[model samples]
Target: GAGVSQSPSNKVTEKGKDVELRCDPISGHTALYWYRQSLGQGLEFLIYFQGNSAPDKSGLPSDRFSAERTGGSVSTLTIQRTQQEDSAVYLCASSLSKPAYNEQFFGPGTRLTVL
Candidate 1:
């Protein structure tokens, strides 16, 4: 599909383990975002990347969570020392411009389960 794509649609890991999730956005899209939705909770923004600017990582829950975008295209979210509380559906979205007007296409998401 021409839209966003995510890898390892599902993942399972034990507590204290580390994991990396990947996202590939539609070509030419300059803005990318990462979000996490825990069970029974609302969407939580984690990070945002726009063009060559430094990413806005204020939404990251903790130092254990991090993300990076390479060449303004592919992005990867890494979680270290995973805990059961870290389990959630991690979503990725991209748009041609910033939010508020442009529509952002989202990937199906990577389901993380920490047991």
Candidate 2:
């Protein structure tokens, strides 16, 4: 009954701090995705989770970024040792199933600012 949603709509942090961004996907959806949009740039895929399989983390920028989905519902993206370049809008999306080309619903995103 709900669309994808992210928490802390806005986050301001120092260059070396760590931050945790949360996302809640639509109930019953089998596929979830995480993306980042930097200033003047297109959405960048960060990770993908589907059902009970291992997540696709190839899109993650570096070891500093990681995420986890619990019980196939809520997800959390953790950015360790944040950097100025990490400032951007973090978006989350969910679809009915894999082959994610299918229609997806996106969240309002969490705007992260590294000062």
Candidate 3:
């Protein structure tokens, strides 16, 4: 796809179950970011990967949330021991390089429902 693509547009998992959300950014984009948007809330930054530098994980809500970028292209966000509070729309975005100036291309997002 020309733009970012995310797998399993919708996911419903029982509480305590583990889930993995996948995101494939646009080819050649060097910066990838993961954000979570809850009901009636703004986007919350989760993680950021830029080139080969270490990922900035300062925004992750908890230890249960983790993400990795493989080959600087595809990214996977894993949630372990999910809870109802984890329910939200997982969004993936990518930029050419510096997110400050480059326009970010966002995926449709994976709507996660924790029951």
Candidate 4:
């Protein structure tokens, strides 16, 4: 991927349903991150992966949310038994390296709605 790409720019689903958002980071990028942003809230980090370093899943709100990065490139975010509170834009970002932390590029994000 030339830059971060998030799928289903917009998703409208019924409450209690599940949704999966995809992200393809720029080539050669070894660090990927997921963040949740509600209409009136600031970006909340959900997860982060940097090379072989331990993934930081410190911000996942509950067991219903999870994410993973394979081969250190593409990543997916899944929300199980989604709730109305899950409605928000899921953004993905990636950096070329640890020293390039400030250069993380963000994806357009998938706007999910749990009705």
Candidate 5:
């Protein structure tokens, strides 16, 4: 089965544009996580989704960032009014259990370049 998949692989946009990144988790996975890795830095948690539970959006950088999971599977992270600071590698991961164990599998990531 597929581990995780993200679209565009790379994106380039001007400041204030909106970008939507997609994530497809492995089948039967109950937990999904989104993260952003900036140049020369560690990954920054964006959000997490577990089953039908309310998503934990605490890690989102600002109101411009939002995400949604449908049918406990695929997810999307939408960045409204994208900024230069939002330029980073957006990674998605999933696990079989909630809270996402260390065994989670990650996507290749979508690299967003905002100029």
Candidate 6:
């Protein structure tokens, strides 16, 4: 019974490098989410995947960001041509459903640093 998990807990790269963050949600969870947390700003919802289909992707900041979920389980967030402004903690969460009464389980997050 593993909870949500993310790989490469910390990543430091140059300004132009591309980074790929991975997330594995808990088994049987159908709702997955990607979020970004900056220094002082609160968590910003990036993309949401429900049962292998993304119903909401409006939160992606720009074209440099994209994500995909396969088999309604694992998800990967890719950032192309990273910038210093993109440095932040990328968090992934999952829940049984998208209902208002459901609670999301958060992962430890992958901290990306652009130097």
Top candidate by TM-score: 3
lDDT of 6 by residue, 13-58 (tens): 9999989999999999899999999999999999898885645899
TM-scores for all candidates: the values are 0.96, 0.97, 0.98, 0.93, 0.96, 0.96
lDDT of 1 at 25: 94
Model 2 stretches with alpha carbons more than 4 Å out: none
Q: Which window of ten consecutive residues has the lowest lDDT sum in model 1?
A: 95-104
**Candidate 3: where is the Cα deviation over 4 Å?**
none
Q: Model 3 over residues 1-115: C-alpha lDDT tens digits?
A: 5889999899999999999999999999999999999999999999999999999999999999999998878999999999999999999999999889999899999999999
What are the runs in model 4 whose C-alpha is more than 4 Å off?
none
What is candidate 5's lDDT per residue for 8-80, written digit by digit as tens? 7999999999999999998988999999999999999999998998999999999999999998898999999
Q: 1-81 in candidate 4: lDDT tens per residue? A: 367898989999999998989999888888899999999889999999988888899999999998888887889999999
* Candidate 6 regions with alpha-carbon error over 4 angstroms: none
For candidate 1, write residues 1-115 as lDDT tens digits: 4889998999999999999999999999999999999999999999999999999999999999999998779999999999999999999999987676889899999999999
lDDT of 1: 0.94
lDDT per prediction? 0.94, 0.95, 0.96, 0.90, 0.93, 0.93
Query: Candidate 2 lDDT (Cα, whole model)?
Result: 0.95
Candidate order by decreasing lDDT: 3, 2, 1, 5, 6, 4
Model 5, C-alpha of 60: deviation from truth (Å): 0.3
Candidate 5, RMSD to the unseen true structure: 1.1
Weakest lDDT window of 10 consecutive positions for candidate 6: 47-56
RMSD versus native structure for model 4: 1.5
Candidate 4: which pairs clash? none
TM-score of 4: 0.93
The local lDDT score (0 to 100) that residue 29 gets in candidate 2 is 88
Give the CA lDDT, 0 to 100, for residue 17 in model 4. 91
